[model samples]
Target chain A: MAKEKSSTKPESPAESSGHGGGGKSGGEVNVFDHLELLSAMGRDFASSLDIEASLKRAIEHITNYVNAEGGALFMLDDEGETLRCHASVGPVEIIGLTLEADQGIVGRCVQSNASEFIRDVSKDKAFHGGVDEETGFTTRSILCAPMSVKDERIGAIELINKRGGDGLFADSDLHLLEAMSASAAMAIINARMAEALVEQERLARELELAAEIQRSLLPEPGGEDYPVVGVNHPARTVSGDFYDFFPLDDGRICFNLGDVSGKGMNAALLMAKTASLYRCLGKTVRTPGRLMARVNTEICETATRGMFVTLAGGIYDPKTGIIRLANAGHEPPLFHRPDGEFQDFPAEAPPVGITPILADGDEFPEIELHLDGGTLYIFTDGVTEGYLEDGSELEVEGFKTLIRDNAAQDTATRLDAVISLIKRGDTALRDDLTLLAIDDAKGHAARQAGESPEPVSVDIEAAAVEEELLLSLTVPSRADRLKTIRNAVTEAAKLCGLGKDPAHDVVLAVDEACQNIIRHAYGGSPNGKIKLKICRTEGELIILLRDFAETIDVSKVKPRELDDVKPGGLGTHFIREVMDETYFLDPPVDGGNLLRMIKRL
Target chain B: MNHEIKEDGGAVIVALEGDVDLQSSPDARKVLLECVGRKMPVLVDLSGVGYIDSSGVASLVESLQSARKTGSNLILVAVSEGARRVLELARLDKVFTICDTVEDGIAQVRP
Candidate 1:
């Protein structure tokens, strides 16, 4: 290949028209014709957005200007392993011909990143006659040029059999073809970049839409005293984990946990449909087996691409501590009893969307469990497979240990601990972790009666949840500052619908409690801090006061007798007089004491 | 907490206002004890009090004890419903002399 030094631009087009027509063949056209052809190639390539059309016009102009009988333009496929002819002008139909990227005269042009000029194909060792043999077309001469844009090789263009005058190609032909291939290469690269940008935009919109759908599908948080708590953390844009629980008129709570087996839009849409199906059918279906069967049939009828959901649905009766549960290809739910024994209920049937019908009619196999004051945990594999703080997978054993360790916390608080355990760091979860816990409220009540540490498990578990703690304030244990607590308590009592007199009673009760914390818990040290939290759960209001002090033996702290009330000891008496229930709760954090008071609304 | 003290009809009238909690109860105790220590008839006006805790009740009880030792009549006047409830909870209602208004307390204490 010649060094590109000679100017293809003619001194004057009118003056050089004498040799303008390249039909003169191998005698070679004047610089005027080369100038016109080069400009025309640039124009044609730039004018059309359709890359194939531009390349076709470019190759035809190049072949005709060099006065060859046939020509073909080949492009490297996306993987760049093979060169396929995209446009061609020839005696034989060669538009779809394919060749290894490193074969024949054209392949050498691409590999060499330069032009090839062969006077006799049979004399050139790199020339391969496979095309001539297949098409019966004789090729005596060849001119090929590599097409490249900014160091990226597009492919090569090949011209065969010079048609005029000595029938041999010269250096001028190779130079002209090389200049025009650059324009063609530019067009192809630009088209690829534009296509990539469009695909990126399309995916971004789909992810955003899926996120909004997931947000709308999740239900309101379960109340504090309610036996259910759920937490969901997305791996990224959207995840397939979902759970929902709602109360029925008969005092039974219906709940379900599911992991849809896909990602992105498909997973998000299926989650919405399946969760709604369980919630809608769960209200009236009554039996867990029948509900799962109906939802399974519906999912199978509409779901595509072998997508499925591993689900466990149940109706919990708090009154009798009973749970009727059905598991469909989900991870086995762990039931942790108060005495520390765990029972696991694994999947009993195929996943929700895989089979349209059950072997035994339309009902799945169901198990009636007496939770008997134990807690039931249902979670997606994301939790067990998720990376923990130390970057190790939590797995099932680790998850069981986590539950046992935080077993004393309220259900919502324990679920939060599970979420943070797998959250790892500030980074989004590696996989979407969805966890739900069903703590038997009866168990909590029974444990509270026994003065056990069970009711002491504490958590503000606000894991992306609604603000359940209406008031949380930390103030110094100074006696004068108790007024602020009183005012806040009065407002909290009013917000929860306590009448004027009753509200004041609660206010004074909280005030007296703070005073006691200042006096007894802090040893009258004003430097100590007290954290007060007020929350309303179901039909009761709960006030929890936390103090960092020496732990007190709650059994020894007694309210003074009303008949024998003296000036200084009336604080505990006032707390017991107004609040329906009062207990010095066990603090989950070390060295701090927690006192809980409840007033039935 | 805010307070007003004056002599009215041969009685040391001590009126207290605002929520009398643990923080402000000392101030309340100061004003009440100063009046009861005079060994004169003391009429305690509590209508301005909105909320009172046990500490505030303790201050009042201490002042009442001082009044008894000094042989002075200590009468609680216009006790707010909330304060009355606290007093009743401590069974202090049976112990302190409570009247409907300052005039009633003054009439009862002077008669």
Candidate 2:
């Protein structure tokens, strides 16, 4: 592009059109005619809020009225730092283009907050030649005006190259352009604000839908004939914490509680996946350790970076008064024994989905407890981390004391008491709160009647005294010999007229107990001997397994935390789940331990 | 537990029987990993398997990871109800390439 110099100064229309000189070739229009056109343009600008279409019309009117070659309208971007070509009707298409806020004639008009009318192309220092160079559109004279609403400058409009008469813009053209820009600026601002509101409403509706889907995934509280109760309270509309329990076909309940890292939609989505996975895998896996490992593998494959799930879950056999639990990097559950003693089984492994915790070398410990007449309280960190009005936390000790205070209440009532204690005072929960309570209903009932707290003992003694010896066998404490022991136990169960389900359970229990003896009691030595005795009565089947190995430390033999999600340590869990009553008695004076397990028919 | 391995074209097919629990998963993993090590397509037919525990699932996961590393395809065929439920519970039903029968599984690998 070439720059040319022009030194003629623009005059006002009053100075140029004075004396009423008539043109010979064409009809002359007066100042009153321009006023009518400005009035009509103002009316048009006020009629519609479609900023793009209205601005296009306004630019068209300005260029046509002034008889210019073309015109373009620039608008301030969201950040208000640059000018963008929002609408243009010119020789070249520069729409969607951008320029610095203080770069050209248009920028000068915005900066000075005034209109510019030039008769020369190069003489004015404010004139920029970059647009002519880019679009190859030569310019001799131009009119530029700033567009603004209130005191805030929005952008500028520039009409290039006057087309008629002397081919130079006068002060009248700047006057008309300024009037049109004022209305256009207001229309653009109003339209943009409306669009933003619509977008916000759309997003709010979507979040509501997500919350509904999450609510449907939560299970109802309580189970029939089993004193199991659970509750979940989310800090936000959507929660990362979840708990679930459902009856399995074999007269047992499988339950789980998990807390996904983080909160809101991302955590909620993972919580749904983890909870459903537990429900599905918990049914067939039988062993909590194995079930958790399977879930960890799947979550590890799908979870995003820096995301994981801390979980505790188990299967409770109401008929056997036994519970097998597994923990994965979650807060240990509080186990309340009948003797008013409480124990916390802390995590045995890292949380799932963080790393490979279930591979060949990893270990997932399982805890097997005979509930006989006690309660197991499983919860998320939300409970222990709850804050009081003074900003002090109710740590694990405080939570344990809370449970101890409510120990005499039923399972549902105890859960409520704990929840109230955590939510007491003027403190708000910082995380999703979830709790699950499993109670031995028969034991609770016997305790309520002020009888001996050993409800399980009474039942076992009644059966043992009236029972008949079905079969008895002795075998070496070897992994290889477990199959023979299982076979013998199965035959004895069948002879007692037990159904396929119960018989299978009896065989599995005996096999697992024998395997534990071979591996744990005898340290995997094959030379040690084991004795098996089977008896059946009117309402129960009892089995006694004796091992001549060193006396087992009962406290040390407590089930390992299932959270480890490893490949082993599930034998004790299987034994407890399969049998109704299990007792690891102190070794006799002769140097042997007797494990007596009774399963009610 | 018992497993039978066969070959068809460039793919290896293995059919498993009995419960795939902690006690049996190691053996299943050995056989499955060997098939995957062939660096070709492998298909596991679990129609005869009655039960599968977490360890069994872990073995399958290992095979899957190995198959991805070797650029070989691993598919499950004729998954029994027990296995299918557990796989769905773990959400692996969506991750694994599963077919209703061995014939369909073979077609998937070949095609």
Among these predictions, the greatest DockQ belongs to: 1
Minimum summed lDDT over a 10-residue window in model 2 chain A is located at A1-10
Q: What is the C-alpha lDDT profile of model 1 across A1-601, one tens digit per residue?
A: 0112124433433234322134243333356556666776666656667878878877776676566889999888878788888999979878898888888888888878888888888898888788899989998988888888878889988888887577877677777777777767877888888889999999988888878778777778866576888888888788788998988755678899999997767787899899998989877577788889889889888988689999998988775577889999999999997679899998889889998868877788888888878899999999999887678899999888988888777787788888888775786677789998888866557544764434344453331134356788899999878878888998898899889989988988898888777766776789999988888777888888888888863422333322223345577778888999887654555677887789999
Weakest 10 consecutive residues of candidate 2 chain B by summed lDDT: B82-91
Error of 1 at A271 (Å): 4.2
Candidate 2 wrong stretches, greater than 4 Å: A1-50, A65-67, A76-82, A90-92, A109-121, A134-136, A146-154, A161-182, A223-226, A336-342, A357-360, A370-372, A387-429, A441-601, B1-111
Model 1 earns a TM-score of 0.50
Contacts from the true interface found in each model, as a fraction, amount to 0.68, 0.05
